[model samples]
Target: MLFAGIDVGSTTSKCVLLSDGEVAGAALVDMGIGTAGPERAYSEALAAAGAAPEDVACCVATGYGRASWKGADLTISELTAHGLGNRFLFPEARTVIDIGGQDAKVIELDAGGRMANFVMNDKCAAGTGRFLEVMAGVLRVPIGELEALAAQAEKAAPISSTCTVFAESEVISQLAAGTPVPDVVAGICVSVASRVAALAKRAGVKEQVCMSGGVARNGGVRRALERALGVPIVWSAQAQLAGALGAALHAWHKSEGQRGEVKYG
Candidate 1:
């Protein structure tokens, strides 16, 4: 059976096409200001998979805009979808840390690879990709360059602020004080990692930790998070596609009318 998943997030939208529980195609695109992202992403994914919408047996939507998606068979929480997606990719993964555009989450998995507990930072942007974007603008550096720039630092400077606006001002002040750009950028990464680490601790981290979402692409944040959590982190080419992949898996499972352990591909 053909199953599809769409994740419409705060900053981007993603879609995945699955055929008999295996990925056939996927698409990711920026989700600007409207609710049209899911449709666009899905259309692209369908084209890539060489399948029409009528060929899909089931479709599931996830992320912040899941409910607003058109023609979705169902909607699931990002937490559940991410846990499933990560476990599907890494069967040994017991902990998951997802840092998306506007929020971050830490999920603990049970022995059977099901989500057991999770903690999230939804009240603030400090632990998210948005925070890094603001800091990058203040540093006059591209967002994609922050990771490499931070890697050049000898020692990370102190950001000292948990608020996004406050942190931007702190960066400005640090620049005025003649602090190196690399050091300041490294400090911003460390600050974000620290906040996410706190959430992971609250959710009870275990071995074989995996990180997902768009922010997981940042090497500086990943390195700092590994240090803060004192664990080796695992990442994959499919990291950014975790939520949509999991939603597709759920759609397949639902089509079978069973709730049991999923056998990985």
Candidate 2:
């Protein structure tokens, strides 16, 4: 039987299909929450798996917007979903860091891969993907180009503000003072890393750290995070889909139990 997981995040929606303990299909949509993204992503994932929605034996939902989707068999928190998903991808991982469109989180995992402790920054957008978006706008560059530009920086300009508004002003001033765009971009990455590293430190850093969510795809942020936390960060191409994968795994487990199938660890 097929199991489905749908994550309705703040800025994106994702769907994952699991068949007999293996991922059969996955889809990610750029829109989320109040939009039609969840359904669209679910449909695309079904298409990818060559199956109809009725084929799914169970469905789980997660992320900040999970409550908005009434079709799920169950709902899980983002922290739990991320912890499970990252552990599934990297069994050796002891810590998980997720930087999404609106927030940042650091989760510490126990020996058995359960969530031990976690710290989240949802009160501000300063260190989140939204911050990067604002900076990209100020630099007149696309969000995708920020990492490549930062790679060419001779030195990172200082951005001392911890507030997004003030940081944007600082970035503008730096550019007005003739600071290289690359240097400014590098500074922005460092600033974001600094904010998130503080949270990681509070949660207590551990070896074998895995980064998930969309910002994990930013090479500049990844390098800066590594520097700040004094550890190498591990990630995968499917990092952005971790939440949905975890939800799908949960669905699989629930479905198996209902079918009276022997569970696999």
Candidate 3:
């Protein structure tokens, strides 16, 4: 049976279609000001899979905006979904660091691949994708170019503040001092990594550390994280879709249980 998972995140909505135990299709779309992002992601994923909504036997929703996705058969927490999905992708992973649009999380998994403990940073945007966007705006640089710019830096400028507003002011001051853009950008990446590293330390990192969410796509952040954690980080092409895939896996498991019940009933 086919199953679907929709993750309605704060900044983007993602959908994953599973044909039995295999991932069939996935899509991601930016969340608009309204509640249309999840619907669009779901439709686009189904279209990519060449399957209709009726073909999906079950659908699970997750993420910050899951409550808005009323069409789902059930809802689960983003932490649960991300833990399951990351475990599926990297069976050896004992720690997960997820930095999404508005928040950052560090999840530790036990030997049995279950969630052991987790910590989250949601009080501010300093360690998240939104923080990078804000800094990009202040630097007049495109968000996509941040990694490349950081790569060119020989020495990163020190950013003393973790507050988003204060960091922006710091960047402005550096620019006023004729500091190179690459140095300032590198400092921003290091600052974000430092913030997230502290959270991971609080949660306790284990072997085979992996990262997820949109921010994981940034090479600069990854490098800084590796330096901060003093370990190599593992990430996959499907990192951003981990939560959605986990939701689909949950739906599949739930569908199996329902089928068993019906047969016995």
By lDDT, who's the top model here?
Answer: 2
Candidate 1 similarity to native, TM-score: 0.95
Better of 2 and 3 by TM-score: 2
lDDT of each: 0.88, 0.90, 0.88
Q: Per model, how many backbone clashes are there? A: 0, 0, 0
Q: Give a tens-digit lDDT track for model 3, residues 184-214.
A: 9999999999999999999998989999898
RMSD of each: 2.0, 2.9, 4.4
Candidate 3 backbone overlaps, count: 0
lDDT ranking from best candidate downward? 2, 1, 3
The worst-scoring run of ten residues by lDDT in candidate 1 lies at: 256-265
Per-residue accuracy of model 2 over 58-103 as CA lDDT, tens digit each: 9999999999998899999988899888888888899999999899
Alpha-carbon TM-score of each model against the true structure: 0.95, 0.96, 0.94
Pitting candidate 1 against candidate 2, the one with the higher lDDT is 2
lDDT of 1: 0.88
